[model samples]
Target: MTPFERSRGSWTFPFPGLSLARSPPDDRPTFWTRALGETPEVYGERLREQDDATWRAIDPTRSKLGAALCKGLRELPVPPRGRVLYLGGATGTTASHVADLVGRRGGVYVVEKSPRPFQRLLDVARRWPNLFPILGDAREPRTYLSWVPPVDALYLDISQPEQAEIATDHARLFLRSGGGLVLALKVPSLRKGGGRGPLSPAEEASRSLSRSFDLGPSVSLEPFHRGHFVITGHYRGTGREA
Candidate 1:
C-alpha cells in the first residue's frame, strides 16, 4: 500500500490528527517545530514527502489530540455531515483538522471563553465556512446554547479541574442520543494524589460520565503529550444528579 493510501480520497492521510495532507500550498519548505511554540518568521505551509505524494504536515507531535491519536486511538465516532459542539477551541489548530473531517456538509460550533483565542478561532472559521466560533464561557452551556444547534458529537479541550462536569453540562444540553464525544483530560490540572501511575484524571471523568455516556477504550498521550488522557464515547443515560 502507498503511504498516501487510505479509505478516503487522495487528499486525505491515514493519520487521523491530520485529516488530509495535500502538497504544501506554496513552495515553502516545512520542517518540524514544537507544539505551542512561536516561530521566528512567517513561513507558509510545508509539504512532507512519504512516497510520491507530498502530504501537508500537520504534526501530531505538536498537538495533544494528534499525540493521543498517534498513541493508539481507534475511531473518530463523528458521523459525516453531522453537527458538532466543540468546547475550548484554542486558535483552531486541532479544530481546523476536525472541521476538515466534517467537511462542508457538516458544521462545528466552537466555544471559546477568552477573547485572544476566540479571535484566532474566528480567523479559522472564516477560511472554513462550516466552523462556527462562539465566544462564551463553557462553564455555562446555556450561555451559548442558542448559538449552537443540536449536535451529533461533542469535543472538549478545556484545561480546568471541572472538565467532566463541564462536559456533562454541554452534552446534556446539545448531544443527541448515541452522539459521539472526545474529551481531552488534562491530568496534571486535576487534583494530584500522593502517588501516580498510569492512573489518570480521565478515570474520574469517565466514572462521572457513566451516568450519561458509554465510554469506549481510552489511551494515554504519553511521551508526545505527557499527563493527558483521551476519552471517546457516546451519550448513554440520564446524567448523575447535582
Candidate 2:
C-alpha cells in the first residue's frame, strides 16, 4: 500500500486532520483516516485502491505519529516531496506510512541500529522506492550522512536516555533550512536513572531544540503510550539562531 490522496483540496497541513474525521457516521469512525479514497480500511491492513494505487491504515495505537494526528495535531511538518530522516526506524511500520505520505517525489532515509529491524525495513523498502533503509545507529548521524540528502524533516523515536541529543545531532548534520523535526520523548528512559541536570526530560529536550528550531505545540500520547511526548518544530539552521 502506497501514496495518493490527502484529506481535502488545499488543506494539506499534515494531511487529513479534518474536523469531520474525528466523528464519522460509522461506528468505527476513527478506523479509516484517509488522504484520499472512501473505503474504510483496518489498522495495519494494507489494501490496493486501484491498479496503481495502494493505501495502508495508519493505526493510532501502533504509531505515535498516528496517535498525534488522531489527537488533533493541526500541522504535519513534513511536506509533500519532502525528504525525512526517520531515527529508530523500527521495522518500517510508521516509516512505510511516511513513505506513502511523501509520495514518489520525496524519500525517507531510515536509520536502524539493530540488524533484525533493519532487515525488516529493507523488506518494506522493496515495495516503495522512496524508502531508504540504513543499517546504522541513530546516535552517529555522520555514519549514515552520505546516504541521505538534505532532508526536509527529522523524526526521532529512539529510546536512549540522551535521545534528544541524538536527534539534535542529526538535525545539525542533515536537516536543511526550515526543516521539520518531530522528537518522541520516552520519559521512562530518563526516569530509570534518576535523570541528570536540573531540568526534567521534556523541558530539557524542548530547551535544546529551541536553540535551532522554532517549536510548535507538543502532545502527550496518553492512553496510547504512557509518558510519551511528541514535539515538532522547524529547523532554522545552526548559523542563524531561531
Candidate 3:
C-alpha cells in the first residue's frame, strides 16, 4: 500500500515520520513520529522506543493536520529536511510533529498571535532545536516576515475570516514558486450565509486560492474535526518553473 492508504484499518507512514510497525490485528492503525530530541511528553501523547529512537503517537482528534493524514490525505508538501512556516501554531502540539518530520536539518518557524499560547510555544521551542516560535499575528504576515526565511512549505490553521487571503499573501512572500501550501479552511470563519452562492466555504476558498496555487488533494477532516477542510497544493505564482 502507498504511504497514504489504509489497508484493512492499518496505515502506512507517509513522509519523514515513518511507522515502526503495523497496528494490532483487532485495532486501527496508529500514526507515530520519531521524537526530534531527548523530549518529554508534549500534550501527553503516548511514547515508545525502538531501534534507539523515540516515537510519539499523533492524536488526530486534537490536530487538523493529523486528522487530514488519518483520513487519507493523498499529498503532503512537507519533505525531510524541508523548512516550513506554520501560522497559528497554538501551543506547539502539531508544530512539534512537523518538527519531527523535518528533522534536525530543517526548521519550522511558528507564528502565533495570542500571548497565552505563545508562552507555551516558547517553552516547547526551547526543547526543540528545529522549532522557532514567533509572537505575531498570522493575518499580518509582514509583522514577522523578517524572522522567517523562504520555506519549502507554508501551513495555515488560523481562525480568521480571510484565511485564504492571508495564505495568498504569505505564499507570494515566503514560498518558492513550486513550494507546497497546506491550509486548514475553517468554514465557520467565512462570511455569514456562506459567502458565495451554492458553493461551500471550502470550495470558495479553493477557488480563490486556485488563482495562485495549483490545487491538489483536498481532504475533509470529518469525525475528527467538523467544518474543516485541509487543502494541499503547490504555488504557481509568477516565475513558476515549467
CA RMSD of each candidate after superposition: 7.2, 5.3, 3.9
Which 10 residues in a row give candidate 1 its minimum summed lDDT?
A: 34-43
Tens-place lDDT digits, model 2, residues 32-143:
3222323323234534343334445567788888777666666779987778889998888777777767767878898889998788787777766788989988867778
Flag clash pairs in model 1.
21-56
Cα TM-score per model: 0.76, 0.82, 0.89
lDDT of 3 by residue, 115-136 (tens): 9999999989989999999999
**Whole-model lDDT per candidate:** 0.67, 0.70, 0.81
**Candidate no. 2 TM-score:** 0.82
Off by over 4 Å in 1: 1-55, 192-200, 238-242
Instruction: Show the colliding residue pairs in model 2.
Output: 5-35, 6-35, 14-76
Q: Over 4 Å off in model 2, which ranges? A: 1-43, 46-52, 193-198, 238-242
Using lDDT as the yardstick, the better of models 1 and 3 is: 3
RMSD value for candidate 2: 5.3
User: Which ranking of candidates, highest lDDT first?
Assistant: 3, 2, 1
Over the full model, what C-alpha lDDT does candidate 2 score relative to the true structure?
0.70
**Residue-wise lDDT of candidate 1 within 146-237, one digit each (tens)?**
67778888899887888788878877788887888898887777765211445455566778787778888887888767787788888874
